[model samples]
Target: MRLPTLRRTRTVEPGIVTGTARLDRRTKRLVGRLRPGDIAIIDHVDLDRVAADSLVAVGVAAVLNAKPSVSGRYPNLGPEVLIEAGIPLLDDLGETVFQAVREGANVRIDGNTVLLDGEPVAHGVRQDAETVAKAMADAREGLSVQLEAFAANTMEYLKQERDLLFDGVGVPEVETRIGGRHCLIVVRGYDYKADLDVLRPYIREYKPVLIGVDGGADALVEAGYTPDMIIGDMDSVTDDVLRCGAEVIVHAYPDGRAPGLARVQQLGLSAVTFPAAATSEDLAMLLADEKGASLLVAVGTHATLVEFLDKGRGGMASTFLTRLKVGGKLVDAKGVSRLYRQNISGSSLLLLVLSAVAAMASAVAVSTVGKAYLGVASEWWDNLVFQIGQLLGRLF
Candidate 1:
């Protein structure tokens, strides 16, 4: 297939772009410090799996995508981010894309032409997108692997700057009837936001205490719910929510001091610093169970070796270990939007009934006393009216 060439609209190192870097470990490890003309080799991506929003924020030129950015239910949002950033991105050649392109394929991009080992790959890839979609579908698993590799590499890149995810507070198992458990939803990726929107109704109905891990707070507010707690390292989360009234839990390593907490403290907000090795999601569950919460509902929690490793760390050794710590007390809401069937909008029904009562009382008061309320205070009139309203509302 005729591939598109990368136009150097953005400054990047050319010859140094290694094609085999499905993992962005060394690439992003040197993100802000890269001198202009650095070519970045990215793993795979399809439409459904274009994560790595942070990489796009920094300047990287000429990406050789190792996966389909969009495949299955996932969306390829990463390329779009790259395009906006004026980064030149190219598609790989089938199995050969993987087999021939080992770790360190010398990638050369001039204008729209991309040459890897003297073979032209992509250049000015303007065509009907339907064909592009079919190509992406054809390259599904390969692409997913590529994207996942990049994510895995990204964690390695991040560790050079700082270590995020933790091992978690040590607790064998938690048993608590803490009814109306305050739930904290955590998400590092964008896919979980869609699921969060789906569960908004049920969460409100149960009135679970809502806690967000950094960006999850914005995710909740975007879904029209206010957060009661916010936790995380505070790297990706916004300042407004960081200053929000919700309780802020700064995730610290086993040692007791945390950089995220330090930032929060500088803002003069009260922060409870907790030491753990698991991700903030672990802390969320631990906090709920430790605080005597009834049930802990987790959203976008991580599972599997790939996900845990992609998050960077010694795997989710801490999260896996922590799961043993609070597994029974936690409900993984990864697919909650798909599995949970919601019925009866709780808050809406409450508002509807409140409006109806307000209208009826206004009518009664206006007709009898020219006031907004019936004013049957401490009298037989008020008691009788209230009883009748309650009886009729319950009956019909």
Candidate 2:
């Protein structure tokens, strides 16, 4: 049997990066299909950190954005993330690049221009650390406007989902009992893996009910645990995870349209519909709170205002409102990891053990009965060492 060779990205010239182009209008969907050395062509405006991290993780040769990576609406973190990862980013290539370039086409990015077969398909600004920093600074100046917009969106979401937010009117019932239990809601967002790693001790000790939101189910599975329940639009999750015997809940639109429900049904799996004007992350938190979870620990869910805006959705307002509603029971995974750090270091534990052993030895040496037992132990040790020496001598 012959093995296929792996394709590696290479610089064709001094400043030109060459690789296969992987194009997608949706950055999230594109990231799933990306391979190392592929040039990612995405249409994400103000590309967020999570997407950038995914691109970096895939080791893409370069990123070609159809829209401005930093529109200066707010200090979005994605552009900086990509630049810092040493990945070349050609920004604002326009939507025409998508029409001009085909998927898996051999492409080269020479400085700020994207070329196919030595012909230029698109041209844009080449973003570096300095450019990204300047954009981020400019974006920070527009923070107040974004905050006002966020406030308005919050009010709009409150008006639309007041019943669900306040009364838990539409929360779905699930077989996994969350009542009086710690609930860990995982989202495949910022630092999810690190947070999960730190929470291993907590998870083992408390045995929290694991609830994975869409791709978060995959995150949990990747971290070597099965979700108790999976909630989301079902786009990013895998079929294997869906069949992992987890209770699935479809996050639907407020009008009761659950696109995810169709996929679930087709997979021969049953799922409950949760129709609310909220993101899947918000839905998971609300469900946990409604289901009577004693505590809700969130991993990779947006916790800051900048993160909410970075998500580039008006629906993030629902997350803000959701956090307020569940604030009492909710705790961030970072906070838990920090506060729940192992109290003793390895050396400290070893030293304490040695101290205890020394105290026991001193007590044994001082007492007649203990001294007699110690003598017997010493004689047994000597005899064992002599037997080992004799066995080695015979073997040698």
Candidate 3:
């Protein structure tokens, strides 16, 4: 498969573009410190869309990644999004760039080169949409191999998590009333904000039990909805969200080591520790399902092959198992929004227009000016009838 060569439409000249260098090995941590127009330096390999979107939201001028943005593993869309947003992405600068660069230091990117002061430090391939597209196409060729590995992983996961399939074990009891009710599980994945916005009416009407996984809790809070339960390793959730009266569940390793427990303890908050090998998203679904949730609505959860690959999972072993166990009740937020939207047919629209007109007419009828106008219209009709009869009699 031939990958397209990147076009040079928005090429930067071989001149210095200076900005404060914000360096972090962890992309998520660096995002908080990033300021508009600051250059972002990170060590993310196969950069995912979520991180790319966050960086775009922060309005970074450019990105310098120590690892290959694509890595040929699978077509990661992060680099493409950045390039399309007019933020230049320089990839595969080597791990040494992390050590050489300092936070808040003024760095320069001149064409494909990175420099500190006047000295050259690193050079890399600048990526654009064409390059990313071509890389993704090439990556798809390895899907068969990746799928084999994924199947093996899923088999192993099934062996370990047989209870999830058979007896509903490891499901925790929570104070949230989920049994026989609709549940909305929110994740901080692709276009979650928009999905949540689309769900506003459903949320108001159904008032489903809201479960936020990891940073998803913060997403829910940002959208002005308090989570009924928050579940994850607890690393990405903010401090304020932890105290928002939601029942917190710390997902621990299968060996029962809970790292997030300390943070919860520090806040003088109580949390239930649930140990399992599955992803938090899967765990959340299983918990809701076993707890007797009649319906499960998912937001920002991974549903596509590219999205699964972007998450760096060898195969969607846990996701596959979880969805298999809950697919009967699982529905995407977009699906619900579509159903709600489709209900607004032409007849419904006409009814809405008629109702609006009726409301306006009722308001006008209650006003004195409206009454006077009606009286004038009645007099005009009477005079027109009298004139018509006199003309008829004269003609006869």
Candidate 4:
């Protein structure tokens, strides 16, 4: 096979948003110092709440997609937003591109475009809409790929400390060791809140070792559940949650440039740092297996190809590999909520039926025994009939 290219062909900077896009209050306030035509480099972009019309109204020239929606992952909707706004979008290029070339680089993509890095790379490319669409498709698949890279990096770090960490901690298998025991992972995605509501009773009942991957910790606390442990790079989590009484584990690459650790340390909270390549979600499962959580119930997790790529990730080799390592204890709660029906419990129904039967029997017996009691029973019976009639009237 031919060697892969290190430099991307497209003229793009990973996180740069150029033009007159009206930033959200958060964004506007953040780079408030920035003037019109200045580039905005954002970390993650949500498809929902993307103000396409507003960005177009501001008259931005182009947007740099830092968080590329993978081939089939969650809808980034940035491209559609920019395209509809008549702004060109250069995707998947990040700080590396900017670091590679000093001074600002502007793209001119009307008919075709050219670039001047240290030297020229390519020029006069075809403006094939189909090709651009395909790139967007590939971009959507990037989420899963990025997740795998994270897991792989994490595994390498874990391996270095494996002898020090794994063998000493966990016990022999109790309910099957694959997903691990001492920890439980909760992911907040899709309709996870609704699913967790259904699982709240079960969680209160079983109280499996709790591990929240970043934002899941907040979700746990919001639902009246306590997290025993928390894991993730630490982005997207609130400072309040970082101080929450759980033992925090900060996931980082072996390179040691952990952005979240600073906040954790700044709060003076003691945390165990695990350097691994997998996403916090993967690491949570792996840590559970390492700690020996009996069952791993995942709520609102993204398992499909589309989900993986939406994060601008590559193929999900490591995630698949991690699942193979601990798929047994892993249960997707999406189906659990959908498959089970909710209603009054059997005991409640039985008690209600017995009460009705006893009422009827008491009325009949009292009526049969004596006239005075019969008069009382007749009144009770009439009241019951009237109540039932009113209930039926309302229901019908």
Going through the candidates in order, what is the number of backbone clashes in each? 47, 0, 0, 55
lDDT of each: 0.57, 0.91, 0.84, 0.55
lDDT of 1 at 356: 100
- Candidate that would win on lDDT: 2
* Per-residue C-alpha lDDT of model 2 across residues 1-396, encoded as one tens digit per residue: 011135478887866999999999998888878888889999999999999988888888899999999999999999988888888999999977999999999998898888989899899999999999999999999999999999999999999999999999989878998899999999999988888998898899999999999999999999999999999999989899999999999999989999999999999999999999899999999999998999999999998999999999999999989989999999888555556556788999999999999999899899999989989999999999999999999999
Q: Lowest-lDDT window of 10 residues in candidate 3?
A: 1-10
TM-score of each: 0.49, 0.89, 0.83, 0.53
- lDDT tens digits by residue: candidate 4, 294-317: 777887665654444433343233
Residue 195 C-alpha lDDT in model 4: 81
**Deviation from native of the Cα of residue 268 in model 3, angstroms:** 1.8
lDDT of 3: 0.84
lDDT of 4: 0.55
Candidates 3 and 4 compared by TM-score, better number: 3
Off by over 4 Å in 4: 1-183, 314-316, 341-396
Q: Rank the candidates by TM-score, best first.
A: 2, 3, 4, 1
**Angstrom error at residue 19, model 4:** 16
- lDDT-best of 2 and 3: 2
